[model samples]
Target: MTLRATIVRPDARIVVQFSCGAASAVAGKLALAQYGATHDVQFLNAFLASEDADNRRFLADCEIWTGRQFTVLRDEKYGADVQNVFLRERYLKGPHGAPCSKLLKRRLLDAWKKPGDVMVLGYTAEEADRLEDFRERNPDRPVIAPLIERGLGKEDCKAIILRAGIVLPYMYRAGYSNANCPGCPKGGEAYWRAVRVDFPEVFEARCQVQDELGPGSWFLRYRSGPRKGERFPLRELPYGPIRRNESLPSCSFFCEMAEADIIHKEPTA
Candidate 1:
């Protein structure tokens, strides 16, 4: 989607991209508090089929906590299926990014968004750089980061949710930090090993996708050794203990840095 500034609407909408994560849930509450009186604040969640089913339960709980309904959207082309994107796009992780994000989340949001619409993202103060990167990349897109502005981080968001009497998504309770896809391509070997244990079906399904897409769809790369920087197949990934504290940032619009620890390149178009 080619982005350009549009003439401001007299009654512009405040569109909060709610990703069913703690930060976005709190961001929605904050946005409603700050702009519900003056602006038409709406929550939008681009539902991903690969995300933990508990995310849907969390979404409903968050709606009650925020006292607002969410307009959940699905990818028209891929039906919000991460595996479908990987198969059709014939790619997964790359210097650009995983196609699942571009097809399922980004494009869905772009289609629903309009120029002059104020976008409230879930970026926290700790993720200020990601917010800036998003702004630099899409200068025309007006954004309001309530969490960052409030100086809240992931832990703070979690606390706020609990204080509201809302249960965190099962993904968090299951020891996964972010409520992302069960077998998120951004995860490293250790993370995948955890998936192998927790969500064996998802791990096996992703391995099947790799088999279909060939080597290009591999999601892991060796960090140090003779084969460093080479893509590693998930099926061959060795089993290992997962760090209980291994936390990956929740993936959302403008938070592509989830892959920063692994790959660095210009943002995907």
Candidate 2:
């Protein structure tokens, strides 16, 4: 008996979610290159018309490599504005993980997705929970995780980009784990600590936002109770020089907040 083979023709439109991070952007670029080479797929950037030069550069590189003119869906107004609203309402409380992901990244994708187009996410197998969550949330559309399928983790992604003679995003070299934004409210103490050292201005701005939101609005809570009768340290901690080879710290505190049921009931919609 002979087995029958079924081949699904590639869709004309493909959206690559670009977060300006090393791993995700690289994965998106690779996907675009592959699809452009093999099919009649048009690459779409989540934030194509934004003023961000870095985002523009990434798109330009994709076009250069693929030799195809990709269409960009402009949604500049909604991206940052909605993200700010989400952060102020939902994430300003305790360690709710980066609201920017929900507001800017995922929201952009949801808006741009069409009925038959394949949505490619830049998640690797290393982010198992995230991958599962993406699939669960967007069950209607077929979401492809090419990097995850290839067993390419963060390190492997970096190698791929470097081998292509492309420079990784500055945020990666600046010690950010994933580039959502500068001083994201979802950042943990260690992440903040690193930011305080690497990007002091951004860290200070985040503290200012926390201050304006008042008590209980702060993202960072002492893991352990404060020293008995001891006062909270109002001043910023002196962060040491970051090591180049040092692995970026995970947003562990934000993850805990989700588990601990500490999210504020602010409607994202």
Question: RMSD per prediction, one decimal?
Answer: 5.0, 6.7
Q: Report the Cα lDDT for residue 136, model 2.
A: 46
lDDT for each candidate structure: 0.79, 0.52
Q: Which candidate achieves the best TM-score against the true structure?
A: 1
RMSD over all Cα atoms, model 2: 6.7
- All candidates' TM-scores? 0.87, 0.69
Q: State the lDDT of candidate 1 residue by residue for 235-266, as single tens digits.
A: 98865668533666567765542343224444
Off by over 4 Å in 1: 1-10, 244-249, 256-269
Cα lDDT tens digits for candidate 2, 1-269: 12112232564455555444455556666666567666555455445222234556655665665566655544454545423554456444334355544444445555666667765667665765665654444454455666776678888877777787766656666555554454555445566666676666756665665566554454444445444333222134434444433343222212332332333334456
Candidate 2 error regions (>4 Å): 1-12, 37-40, 48-56, 68-96, 225-269
